[model samples]
Target: MTFKPFAAPTALLALGACVGRQSVLDPAGRDANTLLTLFAVMLAGLIVLWLAVNGMMLFFNKISTRHYDESTARKLIVGGGIVLPTLVIAALLAWGLSIMPDQRAPGDGLRIKVTGEQWWWRVEYWPEGAATPIVAANEIRLPVDARTEFNLTSAYVIHSFWIPALGGKMDMFPGRETMISLEPTEAGTFRGQCAEFCGASHAQMAFDVVTLPQDDFDVWLAAEAAPAMATDGAQAQRGAEVFLAEGCGACHAVRGTEAVGQVGPDLTHVGSRKSLGAGVLEPTIANIADWIAHTDDLKPEVEMPAYTDMPEDDLMALATYLKGLK
Candidate 1:
């Protein structure tokens, strides 16, 4: 009958999980910090209002022995119900409005275009004055101390672009683009997720946000702009052959190779990314192989077809080649 023992542990577990790298409370960027400050101020104001209103009721109902005069009761009602709340709310609203401009500030130099798909993300980096974008998938890298702007849109249904530690959520429309800027002050890898519900795999649609030093980010951008790495091992060579043979090129692309397809996320530097299948699994050979054979099992309603009938050796070889691309 009593679930009190279970309730305490469950609440603690939930609270503990909230303070991770994905939390808004653990801010790493200017916009996130501003938002956190606003939240703190609003919460403080709300707490004050709650205590004041409840304390008045408690005093009259439980603590007070004598009834107050009509004038005193009228003053208490006006102050607690009308004047105090109005002042607190107005002050909080003004403070919130003051920080809105910074959240909408323009980017320093780097601009990123993100497209939300069925269950994944297509990321393109367009540095200032660049003619073409350097394309990657399911991972975002931002230079520290620079305000980076993201142009977000969805290819299918609506999706909300959100990096909780870095900034607030911006709704991504189908044909129209929405923008948000974030200036990261810390260099760390955090988690990002699609805040909007699109389909069955909405919960699995996630990405990694890696903030790097300016120099390192520049080097990475240069590397990402280049073609995929050459296959060195014989097993990897066989995997490349298998990849082309199986028509994986029809949907996926591997630069420097003939696997040119535009239907899915680019695999040019997939091996170097933090996770695979849009944060559904680690980028390990075993996991890759498992994903290839059980795509739908891992992420329901995903667009990619499972290669369940492929031979074991071919599966391993393909995973090996893809894993070595980094």
Candidate 2:
């Protein structure tokens, strides 16, 4: 077989062309760009080394033993093997370590506790000089440009907390706490997921980090800490009755009420949340109704059973009452 010196370059160009058309790479975020650069450099170096090694092996195999003895071939092989591998590995290690963010001091900022459950996340904000922590679930809010420290742990199973745009991942193990700190430089919502495989509903276990302005974050926190409001009008009032009658209180908690079950996400301010089903669906009346009707469809293998048997009118009323909880 003949040697193809241009093969590696052509293959790299082809791969680059394919990636250039991808939506994930087109408008690449900060973390994406960083990872891409790292991968590109590593791949290019490996391809070049592979081509060089294969070319040399082929050339030596074709040559005569009369011209080059065993000692010469051995020397060449040993030198190339030692030097090339050492250089490549050292360069890669240095490059990788250089890209990692400094973890010594991310600065004294907001402290937040993140606890991972089987299929949801509970977040609590501990602001400076606060008597009690402000608690919420599935979604997190932060002030843009403010450095935030997250103390993460798992309540049930082992999970990994990953928000690619902000920083790297941190593992959450039961009884063991890990910390991750990041300064969200932009005001936007970033998607996060459990990078580790946990259980049946692992794919649906997702969350969002919303970076807001200082004033907006303050307002949101104050509102979230307040008590749940009572539903008004005849339909909502009737729905509130349905909420209690349907036995929804078994696994849900509603502030200012007798429902104190902690198996599920707190419904004290479910109406105020941006999304439902642990960020699987938006917080719309229709979405809530669909989720309440068939939660398994929205989140497969979820612990919450489907309420499809419930009457349509009752479902609508229940959704309305839940939406009015804010």
Candidate 3:
């Protein structure tokens, strides 16, 4: 027995349902769910309109053969095609707009700044009643059950910041700022990627959003604000010297040292980050060594040059020192 192909209308409906079940339509969290529901409704309405138009055309084609005067049938078809679709689409547009958040009053929420560069993210936290902002890179930690507003912008090219579990993609345009407000309803680690294609390393440009309980989040924030840990041992001291002497200082910054360049991710507390190389690889000593040795192999268009010219011992020492940055 051979299976038959599905009819066009049935196939379209099935495809629509499949698309609806995905996160882009039926999202997990509350805010995201609301947005997805609105989008799904609009999509479903459009699909219905498409089917109706095709069905009407087929009906007219059949009726014209049987009727001596097909003018009345044509008029009916044209009127229904224009007026009915217009009404349905207008209603859907109104309903979708109704659910969209009001941009005028965003309310009182925790404000954070996210700046997108070539292949990484620069995160800055401005808590309520704080003088100086807390700066971090790649990883973002948010308190569960709090409304957090992100002021997003791009340092170089246009990029989109998206954490699918929390909210929708918000574009980061150069020189101009955009805002995205979301409330993480639960505590968990969610993966985030740069939604737009920015450069050669765009595929490797990923990040993690670690959502924790309010108390845990506060503790982590306090720890992040504290001074960088001091390095001990002869290897680590030598590694620090290699890091400063070998042009790594041109891009990276380690708070208390002379490596104060802002072109690359800050290595001030890099050891504490869950993953290294913008979530491209795990934060192991070996992975760090490989990244330092062959950055181009891991990420071809990364702005940081490969350190393959460095001696193996220097590479090991540098990795060891960076791993001790917590």
User: Per-residue lDDT tens digits of candidate 1, residues 185-299?
Assistant: 9999999999988999999999999999999999999999999995699999999999999999999988888888988999999999999999999999999999999999999
Off by over 4 Å in 1: 1-16, 68-72
Model 3 bad stretches (over 4 Å):
1-28, 58-71, 102-108, 230-234
How many clashes does each candidate structure show, in the order listed? 0, 0, 0
**C-alpha positional error of residue 167 in candidate 1 after TM-score superposition, expressed in Å:** 1.5
Which model is ahead, 1 or 3, in terms of lDDT? 1
Question: The CA-based lDDT of model 3 is what?
Answer: 0.81
- Candidates' lDDT values, in order? 0.93, 0.78, 0.81
Ranking by lDDT: 1, 3, 2
Best-matching candidate per lDDT: 1
In candidate 2, stretches whose alpha carbon ends up further than 4 angstroms from where it belongs are 1-37, 58-66, 98-107, 229-232, 256-258
TM-score of 3: 0.84
Error of 3 at 296 (Å): 2.6
For model 3, the run of ten residues with the poorest summed lDDT: 19-28
Q: lDDT, candidate 3, residue 256? A: 76
